[model samples]
Target: MSTEDIDVMVYDYTVAHGAIPAPLNFMGFPKSCCTSVNEEVCHGIPDKSVILKSGDIINVDVSTIYKGYYSDASRMFMIGKVDKKKQDLVAITKECLRIGIEAAKPWAFMGNIGAAIGNYAHKRGYSVVREFGGHGVGVEFHEEPFVCHVGKKNTGMLLVPGMIFTIEPMINMGKKDIYVDAANDWTALTIDGMPSAQWEHTVLITEKGAVSLTY
Candidate 1:
């Protein structure tokens, strides 16, 4: 299936549940969701020309606005028979996200999230994308507190209780260098053409710890 096919399904399903696809028309984004494949890092517009094939790994990022609230999440999918390296990259990327989430304790520094994720990924010989990272998103589609995936621990904003944000770390199998596609001015890809994977979760910091608002 093409990326546009994925967008249509997500649009219909979100509307069916009485929710609005937040990315539609937001900041001039035309798609209901983002589909990043292979070397594509993020902000990949859904296009009918982009078709899925074997060994392809894609990230489908979906955001929803419901009853004046917003939700964001993204997950990677392995198409057909993927290579061992690609599979490992996908698995390790997911693990990095898990580590980031675990480190996001209530009242902790926002840098803790990035530090944990960066350390784990770097130790595994992977790199984290720097151009884009997670952000505060609940009252609005995007908010303050730019959350980087690589930083020193105990720095940046403090994770206050009742605050909502996203922890999305784009882990690349090769170097971290990336450049934006000037054509659409949205899609970002790895400069070295290496495979990249990302996993995201909208989180809420509670008194006890951080909880994922998106599954």
Candidate 2:
């Protein structure tokens, strides 16, 4: 499904379960979903004021609680007819995520996933944002197994079956520097104001491979 569809589904689940209670107040976020469009790196709160346009790329980040378990996922989307440059960026970014998942086999180190993602990003002349990385998710909103998008091979936590986490790679069209908009306090932007894209999935490491729970 499209990122927007996934985003709406997540929000529906959240509202159905009443999971948007205390955290909504605790985090001080204006909305339950984060719909960040082009030039918005992350945490762009969804609002009627910001309507998506054709050729615009957006990231829909969703976090929700279900059956006492929490799940988080995000995906990139092209509002309409995206140009070749943006299309390539989205394609490669998705590939980088796939590559990272491929490295999440049993007995594999978390660093392997990072190496795979970084290597693909580097090869494509893109840069990965290291400021924010993936983390384990289950009962809590965030958990163990910090998954960085850039690292050396055979390092960090080892993957084991039944382990659930996320591997979200935020890629930039230009430099890797990112800045949070002071005015909004929620939106993150690329330092150069260039476009950025991100894709994420809550994955469970199994004996076969990573199973995407939010897919």
TM-score of each: 0.98, 0.90
lDDT of 1 by residue, 116-167 (tens): 9999999999999988999999779999878899999999888899888999
Best by lDDT: 1
User: Mind giving the per-residue lDDT tens digits that candidate 2 earns over 84-165?
Assistant: 9999998898998888888889888999999999998998899889988899998887789889999999998888999999
> What's model 1's lDDT at 195?
95
**What ranges in model 1 sit over 4 Å off?**
none
Off by over 4 Å in 2: 1-13, 17-23
